[model samples]
Target: MKIRAYRSYFIQELESIFGEDEAESFFYLILEEKHQLKRIDLALQIDLTFSENEIKVWNVILEQLKQEIPVQYILGNTSFYGLDFEVNKNVLIPRPETEELVDWIIKSNTKDSFSKNIKILDIGTGSGCIAISLAKNVANAQVFAIDVAENALATAEKNAQNNKVEVAFWNRNILETYDLEEQFDIIVSNPPYVRNLEKEEIKKNVLDNEPHLALFVEDNDALIFYKKIAELAQKNLSENGQLYFEINQYLGKEMIGLLEKMNFKNIELRKDIYGNDRMIFANR
Candidate 1:
């Protein structure tokens, strides 16, 4: 079928399931991934054609999309902090808000006062996005990452290797241990923070397809991972070490209080692009 004509039908069909914007994004993303054709390619060559085989593959992906499967999973990878990371049902597709967290870590460390040769740890490092991005940007810093799920760690390790950044990957559940066996200059986490009660707020794409172990927490213990990671940081962080978190926006005040109670100083909470309190940083 002519790819140009198909794009309109595809977009119109998906518009009922997802709004036109998302459906359009899905179209472009698939076009680029499948045909190596960018939006500009389509604009310049409106008569581009797709072979029958290519159309078959796209139709399969379209079926998955109609079922609300996340496009990253369908594509088998995603970009985070400008680095490619492999993702599947085993890991959460990196989100824009989490990108802001990476930006916070990168920008915070850019100040020379943080010192070269700084040691950093990324707790619950799904796909190693945070750790790899930090390692790539903080040239002099040594980065390590920990995750409980062996499959998730395996995926993260591949990402580190693919991104050409060295990151120490460990398979240990943060909730079960307080000892990192080494101190770090910075400890950052974008841990599971969405409360079970918020399931309705999550889209079917995420709830059905993303790994639940990396996306949710009990409503009664929404801060469990944050509290535990913070506790470990209190003991494992070097003097003046920085701690960062990609937090649940609703719990900003509560998270700051938790950090203060743990005696974390220089505490700050910042919002993401949507103005939700999405990140917290503190220092020992």
Candidate 2:
């Protein structure tokens, strides 16, 4: 089939689910990932045709998209903080909001100009997006990441290697232990902050495909991970060390209150691109 003809059918099928613009975007994304052809390349060769084998592959992906499977998972990799990360059912796909959180940490560290080696830890580091981004962007940063799921840690380790950054990966449940042996200049987490009550607000694709262990909390104790990480940071952070979180938008005030109760200083809550309360920074 001619490429443009196939593109038209693909977008029409997905438009109801993802909207016209996004459906078009998905076509181009798949073209690049599956065929190494960009939009411009497709445009220049409007008469380009797909072989029967290629059509079969495209049909399979289209069926999955109709079920609301995330495009990132369908592709098996995604761009985060300008680096490629392998993702699967075991790990949550990295989000743009989390990239903003990583950018904040990198900016703060660069501005401080710490001459000594900087130690950093990422709690619940699914896919190691934040940890690897920091290690890649910040000079003199020694990064370590922890996750309870051994499978997630395995993916994260591969991500670190793919990004050409060294990050220590540990498989440990943060809720059950506080056994980090070294002090860190910065500690960060983008933990499970979505309360069970908020599940309805989540997109169908995420609810259906992403790992719940990395995305949710009990509604009654929405701050569980935040509180635990804060307690561990209090003991493990060097004097005036920084702590950061990519937080649930609905719980900003509660997050601030939690940090205040924990006696953290210089607390700041920042909005993401959508102007929602999305990240928090505090000093230990």
Cα distance off (Å), candidate 1, residue 30: 1.0
Tens-digit lDDT string for candidate 1 (1-284): 77789998889889999989989999998888777999898889878898888888888988988898899999999988888899988998998999999898888778575555989999999888889999999858899999999999999989989988899899998899969899999999999999988899998888998889998999999999998998898889999999999998899999989999988899999999998999999999
TM-score of 1: 0.97
Tell me, by TM-score, which candidate is best: 2
- Quickly count the clashes in candidate 2: 0
Tell me the TM-score of each prediction against the true structure: 0.97, 0.98
Off by over 4 Å in 1: none
Q: Estimate the TM-score for candidate 2.
A: 0.98
Instruction: Report the lDDT tens digits of candidate 2 across residue range 180-226.
Output: 78899999999999988889999999999999999999999999999
Show model 2 residue runs off by greater than 4 Å.
none
